[model samples]
Target: MRKVAEGVYRVPARAANTYLVEASKGLVLVDSGLPGSENGILKAIAKLGKEPSDLKLVLLTHRHLDHIGSAAALKKQTGAKLASHPFEKPYAAGTLVISAPRAWSLYGRMVRKLTTLEYWSLKLFRIIKFQTTHVDLAADEESVLDGVGLDGSVVWTPGHTKGSVTLFLNQPSVAIVGDLLRARRGRLVEPLLMESISQTEASVKRVLDLDPEIICPGHGKPLPASKVKIEKRIVKPVVVAKKKEEEEDLEELTSGLF
Candidate 1:
C-alpha cells in the first residue's frame, strides 16, 4: 500500500492486490481490490501520513472483478480521479462488453462467466456494506499518469483481456505488468487468465524491449530486479531482451552474487 519505488507499490488485499503509485502531489491507486478493499487501502494510505487529498488518481490494469471491484465506490468516497485505457472504460461504467478473443479455453469460459456475478456484486457492493466504482479516468495508447510519477505510457498488452495493459516506466526501466505476468512466491509464470498464448507472448516481447528494471505484477509478487535481474522471465521476452541492444542491460551482473 505504500510506495516501494519512486511511486509504485503492490498493496495486499483480501487474497488479491491493489497497487498505489505515489507522486509529488500525492498518490495514485491502481486496481482497487474486491468490495471491501478501500478500507484496507485507506488505512495503508494513512500509514503513509497522507490524507484524502493524497489519493489523486485511480487507475485500473483491467476491468476484472478481483482487479477493479472497488473503482466506483472509491471515487465517490475518496474523490480520487479514475484513469484507465479506453479499452477498459466500458467495463468500469458497468458495461460488460468485449469481443470474443481469437482463442477460447475451458478455463477462460469459466472466468468469463464471472462477469455476470461481478456485475451483481458491484451493485450489491454499493448497496450492502461494501462497494465498487466506475472508471472516471480513461486514457488511450500512450497516456502518462504523472500523478503517479510515471514518465511512461500504458501499453496494450491484451490476451488476458482486450484491455489488459502494462505501465511502462522509463529512465531506469520499470514495468507494471498486471496479471499478464505473475511471479508466485518469487517464481514467475504466465498467468491463468491468458486468452491467447500468441498475443500474450507478443505483448511480452513488446515490453521487454524497454529493458525493464523490475516487473511488478497483479498476482504473486514483484520481480526482484536488483537481485534477479531481467525484464521478464518469459523465454521469448528474455530472449528479446538479450538479443536487442536497446535492452542489453537486461544481462544480470552474473558473478555468483545473486
Candidate 2:
C-alpha cells in the first residue's frame, strides 16, 4: 500500500488496485479489487493501524469482475455498505449480463493476439473465481460522499462501462479513475475494454473538464494528469518519430498498430 494523498492510500489487490480513504466517520474503501483479496486488504489495513470494522463504505467505480471481486466478502467482514451508480446496481446484484468487448481498437487487437491456450487459461480462472454481490447504496449523480471527511465527489464518467465513475478530491485535485484510462509504458491510453466508444470519448472530455492533477488508475501506476492526450483516438497510434528505434518504442508502448 502507498499513500497518494493526505489521507488516501492506494492498495494493490493483485492486478487491480483499491483505495482507502481516511474519512471523518471512518475509512471509505473505493474499490475492492479481486476475489480472495480479503486477507491482503485486512493486512494492509492493520499495517496502517486501522481495523476491519473501521471501514464504513465500499464504493465501486463500475461493475467489473476484477474491480468488485472482493466486494461481497469485504462487506460481510467489515459490515460496510456497498455503493455504486444506479445503472450499475443491477450488475452488482448479479442481474445484468456482461459480454466481452468487441475487437475494434488497438487494445482489443492485442487482447485478441493472445494464444488460444493462454486465453482459455485466463478465462477459466475468472469463471471459477468471479463472484457478484449486492449494492446497498447508489449515487444518483455527481454527489459528494456524505459522512466521509474527505471532500470528494463522484463524477459520472461513463464509457469504459455505462456506469463508470471517477472520484474527484478537492484538496489534491486527484482523480481515482477506474479503467477510464490505462498506462502503457509511460503514456495514457483508453482502457483495455470499453462498452461504448462514443460515450468513452465524451467521458474523456468530462474528465479533462475536472482538471485533475494526479490520476490513480485501476491498472497502472499513478500518473500526472498531463500524461493523457484526449485527442488521440484509441484505434489510431500516435507516431512520435520516423526513426526505426523511436517507431519501435511506440509499437512496444501501444498494444497494436495498424
Candidate 3:
C-alpha cells in the first residue's frame, strides 16, 4: 500500500486499485479490487496497525467486475457497510449482471472489445469469474463522507458508467476518481472505455471545476490536478441525441442479463 495523501493509501490488489482511507472511527475502503483480493486489503489494514473489523465502510464507484470483484468477500469478512450509487445497486447485489460498456473513440472501442474478449476467455477457461456483492448504502450527489467520519463528499461523475462517482477530499483537496480519468505517461487522460463521451466530458469538467490539488484515479498513479488540461484537448463536440441513444442501449443490454 502506498500513501497518496494525508490519510489515503492506495492498494493495488489485482486488476484494479483499491484505496484505504483512514477515518476517525476506522478505515474506509474505496473500491475493492479483483476477486480474491480480500487477503491483500486485509493485510493492508493490518500494515496500518488496524484490524479487519476496523473497516467501517466499502465505497464502490461503479459496478464493473474488476472493481466490485472482491466486494462480497471483503464485506463478509469485515462486516463493513457497502455503499454504491443507486443505479449500481442491483448489479452489486448480484441481482443483475452488467455488460461491457459502449465506446465512441477508436481506442475506446478497441479496449471495450478486448475487455469483453478477455472476460469471456477467462470464464471459458474457468480461470476466473465475477463474484457479485451487495450495496448497503445508495450513495448519490447528496452523500457526504461526514456520515462515515471522513471529510469529503461523493460527486456523481457518470459516463464511464451511469453510477460512476468521485470522492472529493476536503482537507487535502484530492479527488479519488474511479475511472473518471487515468494517468498516461504522467498526464491525466480519459478512460479507455466510456458509456457516453459527452457525459464523460461533462463529468471531467465538473471535477476540474473543483480545482483539486491531486487526482487519484482507479488504474494509475496519483498526479497533480494541474497536469490536467481540460480546455485545450479534453472537451469536444458530441451529439447529445447519440449519447442518449447509447446510454439507453447500454441500459437495455445490461438489463437483459439475468
Candidate 4:
C-alpha cells in the first residue's frame, strides 16, 4: 500500500484494494475492498484517524465481483456514493454476465456459485442485494466533484471491461487504475475476461501516455512514473456497444438488483 500523496491513502489488500480516502470533502473510496476485508477497511480508516462517514464516493474502476464485492455493504453503512463506468454497471448490480459455454469458461461463469475465478478469491454473495446511491459517469466526459473530496476526471480505459475507467489527478498525476494494470499480490492481466482483445491492448497504452507519476493498479503494488513503460502506442477505445443500450444496463446495475 502506497500513499501517493497526502490525504490520498492507497490501501492494497490481498487482491489490491485501492481506497483514496481523502480529507477535504470526505473519504473517497476508489474501490471498495473485498467482501471479507470490509471490516478491515473500517479499522484501517479508523487507524488513519479519519471519520468513517468522511467516505463520500466509492468509485469502481470496473464492475468485477472482487472490486464491488462489499460496495453495497459499504454504501449502506456509510451512505457513500458508488460511482462506476457505464460499461460495468450491470455486473455490479448483481446480474452476473454469465458467458455462453466457451465464452463462459474463458470469461467467467459468475452467475453459478463456486464456478468463476472470483468465487475462489471471494465467496459469492448469497443474496447480494446490497444497496447504494449509484452515480454513473461517462467515458468521454469528465466528472469533477468539487465540494466532494474526489478531485479528478474519470477516463474510459477499456480492455479489462468495455467500460472500465481510471481516475487520474492533474497535479499529483496519480491514477487509480483498476484491473487495467497488474500491481499487487499477483502479476498478470485481469483473469481471463475479455470482450475484444484488441481494445485491452489499446487501453494499456492510453494510461501510459497520461504520464502519471504514480500507478495505482487494482491487484498489486503501486508503481512510480519511471516504473511504467509504454509497450505500445495509445489509441482511443472504440466503444463496441450502443450508448443507449449501455445506459439501460447502467441504470439497472446501479438502481436495484432483481
Candidate of highest lDDT: 3
lDDT of 4 by residue, 1-258 (tens): 456676667776535576664636777777776565567677667877776686777788776656776777777777777778766777676555523111112123333223544554333444443333355443334444554745567778887677788877766677778877665333333323455446666776677778887777776667775665433322222232224435655998988865
What TM-score does structure 1 among the candidates reach?
Answer: 0.72
Model 3 Cα lDDT, one tens digit per residue, 82-194: 88889988977767657766655556656766766346435622566666666878776454466668888889999989999888888788898998888888988878777
Which candidate number would show the highest TM-score if scored against the true structure?
A: 3
* Decreasing lDDT order of the candidates: 3, 2, 1, 4
The segments of candidate 3 whose C-alpha lies over 4 angstroms from its true place after superposition are: 117-126, 141-144, 230-258
List runs of model 2 lying over 4 Å from the truth.
Answer: 110-127, 141-144, 234-258
Model 1 lDDT, full chain set: 0.65
For candidate 3, report its TM-score: 0.85
* Alpha-carbon deviation at 8 in model 2, angstroms: 1.3
Q: Of 1 and 3, which scores higher on lDDT?
A: 3
Model 3, residue 142: what's the lDDT?
51
lDDT winner, 2 or 4: 2
Which should have the higher lDDT, number 1 or number 2? 2
- What lDDT is reached at residue 125 by model 1? 46
lDDT of each: 0.65, 0.75, 0.81, 0.62
Query: How close is every model to the real structure, measured as TM-score?
Result: 0.72, 0.82, 0.85, 0.71
